[model samples]
Target chain A: MGKTIAEKILQSHLLDDGAVVEPGNIVRAWVDVALLNDVNGPIAFRHFANMGGGPVARPDKVVLVCDHFAPAPNAPGARLIGDMRRFAQEKGIEHFFDVGKGGIEHTLAPEQGLIVAGDLVAGGDSHTGTAGAFGAFGTGMSWAGMAAIMMLDETWFKVPESMRFELRGKKAPFVTGKDVILRVLGEIGVDGALYRSMEFGGPGVAELNIDERMAICNMMVEAGAKTGMVEPDAETEAYAKAHAKRAYTLVRADADAQYASRHDIDLAAMRPMVAKPYSPENVVAVDAAKGVHVDQVYMGNCANGTLTDLRQIASVLAGRKVARGTRAIIVPATQQVYVQAMKEGLIEQFIAAGAAVTTPTCGACFGGHNGALDDGEVAVATVNRNFKGRAGHAGAQVYLANSYVAAAAAVAGEIVDPAVL
Target chain B: MIFEGNIHVVGDHCDTDVMIPGRYLSLVEPCEIAKHIFEEVDPGFVKRVQPGDILVAGKNFGSGSGREHAPFGLKGLGLSCIVAASFSRTFYRMAIDLGLPILTCEAAARAAKVGQRARIDTASGEIRIDRQVFRTQPMPPFIQEIIEQGGLTAWVKAEVARRRASA
Candidate 1:
């Protein structure tokens, strides 16, 4: 009869006094942080304007990130960013991260400590679940829902049942949170956790770093999950203390918390997993997909664009040259991460290895711009979601892998385990 | 609300990208975005769909991305309803906000055929397709109220007016 972490967080933020928090019960809740991006911001603002245009309830809590089409990919994209800039200035919204100031919202939000444990965060982007890595209850909402939040500082939710994932054992060499999540997706298929919170815990949770945790939670949406969370621990505390801008409470699931279903994942048993074209759930071990030729190898996105991921790629491409006929593009997730990578020499090393290191934008990952694939091109990327046309032309194929695997593909021009190199 | 129409069928995991490719996301007009819906998977979808047509699909419909354009485009195409085995949580909320009725009935989704005449009663959760009667959980009273008010925007407008009056 105990409550899950998600349940407890939602309970504390309930807007209706004395409202019960349980799965399938709709409850109004206040959010501590709300994110809007270029793609959703324009629409949300239009709705806000149509609702008789008033000052937002919490300008400080509202975050507008121009990431999806940062630097203005086209005329329309520029217009969208222009709208965001003008609105931010007029409304006095505090946390507007423009083109060069930020990268992806999910990465920048956490890096800037906009969110902390036990807070309820909502964003118009599906990857808002990425904040759950910090033990916060983060979920995606509609633009209209966000507009309503902007007006009232609150939204509604049908409390979702929690699916407990007990990760046990330390990960093997070259294995990462990306592989761990890919393996989980392979086990459950896409809709296995639909509308359910994926709560991670157990001994293996300690073995993964905060960046790894972010990578895992970022893709929970691909599995149709409502949100993804990890139990707060010492590792979480260290990262939060260094970056968190606000006070936070490390919320934990009760000892006897009820779970809709339970899955036990052995990290040691995990390998360099890859999701084939058109589906994140269609996964295969690296060995099974070895020697598959790739025309491009991209290393970036909220899922795998962390500093740790950059280091992993640098380790693989340290002195090697990218294979002939293969293009390697590496993107840092945020401005801070880009500067840190530059200070650490990852950028120079990437460029020296025949790869192109670019600024922190989600352009390539979402096929918005930067490095869209040519027709029939094949790519091995460290990004999540390999859906058709995800990275480029519909005829093109994308293979989702960890940074190590992606970097190895850049060197070998094929899908191969990094350990083999 | 009762909606009667012919159904356009799609399979499971029909993501937002396939529904409305990410490239067209910057196009704010719903009708403009609707011109490209399912262009990749079904190139003829835009040309074939009628104003009152319904969209029938398997589980995990609208799986990827949180773009409201997917529902906006569908609504622009004048879809009466979307009946599927299930809908991703984000898409479900967007549909509700846009006043687009969506029902979760595995039997109804599985039994539906392309171009088949189907009828749905949102209040009753009854789906009728070719003499088959499938029952689904009806929309909750609160959500029904939102739909009746023509979506969240109108509801918010009325609420804002009421609050000002009270103040």
Candidate 2:
């Protein structure tokens, strides 16, 4: 049988001359890139030191992004972040993106052209599935996995059973990749695709832009998926050539590839969705959440904080007033996203609309900074994962939604359909 | 590693972000991070869990984020072992590297209860609780070797040295 895109990528990285592996098979393959962020880098560096402080195997392929709490949230955060920076310099990893240069690792990797199609990328953070939008077999690893990757450029992967999410039809206004993926998550529940790849394709993938594709794949983690991918096309080539410094190869699944499961999503019928506390998969249409009062609104994280998302939110908030009692926090995903938003006047629109703008960080999303919620409060956030207390107080609730809805909720002080506005 | 302890049960999809909330992520110290493990689920969970305690959890234990703090926190809290119906990929791998034994037995999740004295055999894949016994897939011997060598860091150090020496 022909292989899926994930299988093809894994097979290409096989160390042995004849490594015939299939779904559910455990195979050891070389990792093309080792991705690290401030949150995981310090722990990984400490582990590496504990392992006799060995030199990194391939410095060029190692990327360390300081986006979690850049500018340092506290003394310990600063100290740990400092150690991560020193390790990048000491290891001679030129790809270390610090402070201004770094953004959310998932978003930054694609924009900086660090990841490309037909590669095996291992990110130390779970959202590494974001790279899969580029048609790479991206997967999340722990600190020990990072140690193995850095020291030997190798790790074991259980060739996941593949789930094909075939998308068809055009999306309605305010409904983007986030909606499509959220619908999929709702259908599958959190662990629906456990250890499986959600290979996205069909007419719908071509209809969406690179950023939209990114938004969909970014939430694969939220679905408890190991990876999410879209087959490479002209836009994929164009994006790589425009963003990536190096050349990349395009990979395609065989026409007759056998899939373990297939889910068909009709984009036209997908309504703006929200994942109410405290699970990303516990989704309902925005209208179902009407009058669900929100104390705060957050719209920036590796998942939904893209230029496209900003443009959408900016258009929604331009000339609109944020509700008197609600606080809206807008964070662009990257420095580039920040600058572009400024140039486009989205920054002015947000500020004039009563939103607080912050530099790019995983803040507020992970309950780390800017708009951490207080107990008994509720928030509508554009970030992924609404797991209990994820954004701040353990009792504070968060509703995960698309950027458009985030903007509307910011202004409405409740979960309202942006389309209705 | 053969371990015996009182089982403490946690529910399905016990997210890692909740186990050690993101707020405590900046604190890399094991003991400090352990203070927040299960802080969301139960504020006093860490204080109450004794050394050599075994955690029996429902499906998809340690789901969410790749932060090692979740597994590492449990390790530092003196959790000798965890047996869940299944585990999140990163959490399962982190536990192995932390030298914490984990067994995936469907029966264990339903059979285990708080303060239920249980004995687990990593080699035999047998988990004994009260008068009942559940079988799980035994981890590979090489993995046990890695744990015996003191987890991933020590094993990696030795491997790196061996490679350099061979070269």
Candidate 3:
């Protein structure tokens, strides 16, 4: 039996006494990157202290980011940020990203070249799987698990079985990675890939860029997956060459790799998809949801806040003003992305079109701040999750869509396909 | 370890947001978080839930977010265990790491009713609900060890000391 890409990465990082890298076997493996954010950083720092705080095994590999509650939304949030700063300084952690320095941890880590192909990355945030976009094995863990990694530079995992998603054909115009993933979620339902690795490959993978790949991998968690990945290709190599700070080996699945199951997705047939309120799996075609009034339209998050997304959104909002009754919030995921959007004039177009463009922060996406919804409000956003109370008051509803569709909604004040706009 | 409690039933996809809304994530104290458990989805849940009550739910329980606060809050409220048809990987790991025992048994989860007394034997993977009996795969030795050691925090503490002493 040949090995899958996930198995190969995990096996390469296994400790001397680690178990075999097979499905259902628990193995302790070294981590290349251990990520933390303000929401979970303080707790993890406390655990690190409890475990006899000393110099971290790999300070450079450990990253602390403050985007969840950047700039401090309240006193408690401020305290969390303060604790992260103190710990970062005390430990001499080299990759501590404070507010105004970085954006969301997921988006920031990759842009800074902290992750590379074949690396095993763990973080305290669910969307940590976004690193899979770089052809690395990325998964989320508990704070205690993160603390253990911080101290010992290793963590345990029960190897997940692999599920292959073969992408074929080119995607339709205006259809982004968000639509592709929503379509997958609709097919698999929540838990369809429970505790399994979702591996993307085939010719269609070439059609989507890094941003689209990131968007696809980021939502693997929504399908209850352990991680999501794309096989390293020319585009991946180009990305790594441009940004990677360290050397990387492109790990690919063997020709006869074993997969628990496989699904074929034809990107050409893809269309604008929407996930109704309270569940990412509650999906429908845009036509089914057309004319559904929306009070707000938000574009940006770890899932869809890349430069690609900004360009897509800007293209839709180029000469259009936000509908009279609707408000739009556009957030660039990272400082670099924000600056790039500004240089490209995407930010200007957004603001000139009545959309509020904000700095790099995860505030509005996680309901931390910036633009939480009011009761009874309805929004169409590019965020990954639409669970109740995800973006604000419990009474508010959110629909998940690609950036193009979301921007179209901002201009129409209703759910409409970007193609028609 | 055997735990007996009345189960509080919830439907599928009981996400972390419903368990503890993102707004209250800033509250690190478990007790403070316990007060808001299921506050958004079921307003009276906190008031009605008693100590040692088990949570029975359908598929994909704790389906969203990697926040440990969800399981931490439940443990703080004295939840003895959680039995679900299935659990999201993140929540499942967080629960075990927090020393909160959970079991996945489709039959048991489906058969369970609100206010019914259920008993779970972690060692045997046996679940008794009312007059019905169900069996699930027992947790692996590593996970059992973590639970016995009272979560990863305590386990890591001892491991750190042991490694230092040996070194």
Best DockQ goes to which candidate?
1
What shift in Å separates residue A112 of candidate 3 from its native position after superposition?
A: 0.4
Q: Model 1: which docking level applies? A: high
| Residues B1-167 of candidate 2: C-alpha lDDT, one tens digit per residue | 78998888999999988898888888888888888888877988988899999999999899988788888899999999999998887788788888888888989788788889999999999889988988888987767877777688778778788988999
Q: Best by lDDT, which number?
A: 1
Candidate 1 residue A210 Cα shift, in angstroms, is 0.4
Model 1 chain A lowest lDDT segment of ten: A358-367
Q: Write the per-residue lDDT of candidate 3 for residues B1-167, one digit (tens) a residue.
A: 79999989998888998889888878888899999999877889888888889999999999889998999999999999999999999999888988999999999999999999999999899999999999999888889989988788888888878888999
TM-score of chain A of each: 0.99, 0.98, 0.98
What TM-score goes with each of the models? 0.99, 0.98, 0.98
Pick out the ten consecutive residues of candidate 2 chain B with the lowest summed lDDT: B141-150
What DockQ results for candidate 2? 0.77
* Residue B34 Cα positional deviation in candidate 3, in Å, after optimal superposition: 0.4
Question: Per-residue CA lDDT of candidate 2, range A1-421, in tens?
Answer: 8998898889989987487778877788998889998888888888877777657989988999998878688887888779878998899989988888767888888888889888799988899998877878888887877977888878888888888888889888889888888888899988888888889988878878888888888888776788879878888889988887676889887888889888888888889999989898899999999889999998988867889999999889878999999999988888888999899999998999989998888877888877788999999988889888788888899998999999999888888999777
Worst 10 residues of 3 chain A by lDDT: A16-25
lDDT preference between candidates 2 and 3, better one: 3
CAPRI tier for the interface of model 2: medium
Clashes of 3: 0
Candidate 3 structure quality by residue, lDDT tens digits, A83-108: 99998999899899999999988888
Candidate 1 segments exceeding 4 Å error: none
Error of 3 at A260 (Å): 1.0
**Which pairs, if any, clash in model 1?**
none
Q: How does each model score on lDDT?
A: 0.91, 0.86, 0.90
